[model samples]
Target: MTTDLTAFAHSVFEAQPFSRFLAAELTDVGPDSAEIRVRNRPELQQQHGFLHGGVISYLADNALTFAGGLALGGDALTAEYKINYSRPAIGETAVARAFALTTTRRQAVCQCTVHMLGDGEERLVAVAQGTIVVAAKD
Candidate 1:
């Protein structure tokens, strides 16, 4: 049976309570790729008045996992990941773009970049790489 992956992706995003609480919108999800966005707010900022590192990492991880699932045509979970923050994420919004860089039957390498969008421009904020493991069907 074929799945309507776009609908599935939206459902997955909606089911996540944290994402909902973060006010993240899953803008796009296709085979091997996905994008998410969140509006910047003071609550999401750190002591330095910039987007918190945890928030940035959260965006990358979820976006990458979604891309991995799209690539595998099934559910996937993050095995491990690493991220590097290049600058303070300060902007009116944050966008995360993720792609499945490589895929096997059961594993995928997902990469993501996050950008801060404000004042009609975007600034690169963080980069992440993750390994996602596709779960076997029950």
Candidate 2:
């Protein structure tokens, strides 16, 4: 089950140019969950040396959508989402993990949590909730 979706998930991630630009990698994906990881680079940081809010939002949005798509068994687009920043995000690495909160025939509610890895410990940085609209199958 997971093995099949693993390849599909990686393909979907690889096909996103923006994900590639941000160096976001799809680490895992299943019927109801997905995980992505990105390295902290200077170029991805804000003036305050924290990862920019936009970067965190990007992770949340994409991770949530990927989770929804897996649960829906096809493509989906982000309809809307909101992210709450817990603190200034600083670390050598960052991870976004998303799970389906609810799913319908054409839509899904997903939650994403962002974490920053520093000194071998992970700290919560942001949380997001997203609505995803599944695409019609051909």
Candidate 3:
């Protein structure tokens, strides 16, 4: 099931042009959680040499939706989200881990934490909470 879920997550991640461009990888996906990781690069940094806040936010939002989808049993979209930065993200890679906090038939409340990994350690960079709704069938 883990392999299947990870494959499903990868396929969905691959379909997003922006995510693909960022070289984001869906490292894990399970019954109520998901994780994404992206390597740091020059283009993804800001003037201060920290990972851009927008990039962190993107990871948080996407991870939250993926976790919600796992809990809800289908694809999900972020209805809304709020993020708080704890520190500048200075690292070789950024990882986002998310889990469903609560779930109902139509939606899930999820939380995520973004971490910066480098120097044999991880630093908490940001945290987020969001509402994710079932995606409309196309």
Q: What is the C-alpha local distance difference test score of each model? A: 0.93, 0.91, 0.93
Model 1: per-residue lDDT, tens digit, 14-121?
Answer: 999999999999998879999999998999999999999999999999999999999998778999999999999999999999999999999999999999999999
Q: Which candidate is the best by TM-score?
A: 1
Stronger candidate by lDDT (2 vs 3): 3
TM-score of each: 0.95, 0.95, 0.95
The backbone clash count of each candidate, in order, is: 0, 0, 0
Give the alpha carbon lDDT tens digit for every residue of 25-137 in model 2. 89878788899999999999999999988989999999999999888877888999999999999998889999999999988999999999989899999999999988755
Query: What shift in Å separates residue 131 of candidate 3 from its native position after superposition?
Result: 0.4
Taking the tens digit of each residue's C-alpha lDDT, what string does model 3 give over 25-92?
88888898999999999999999999999999999999999999888887789999999999999999
Error (Å) of candidate 3 at residue 117 is: 0.2
The weakest ten consecutive residues by lDDT in model 1 span 1-10
In model 3, the worst 10-residue window by lDDT is 1-10
Of candidates 3 and 1, the better by TM-score: 1
lDDT of 1 at 67: 95
Candidate 1: give the clashing pairs.
none
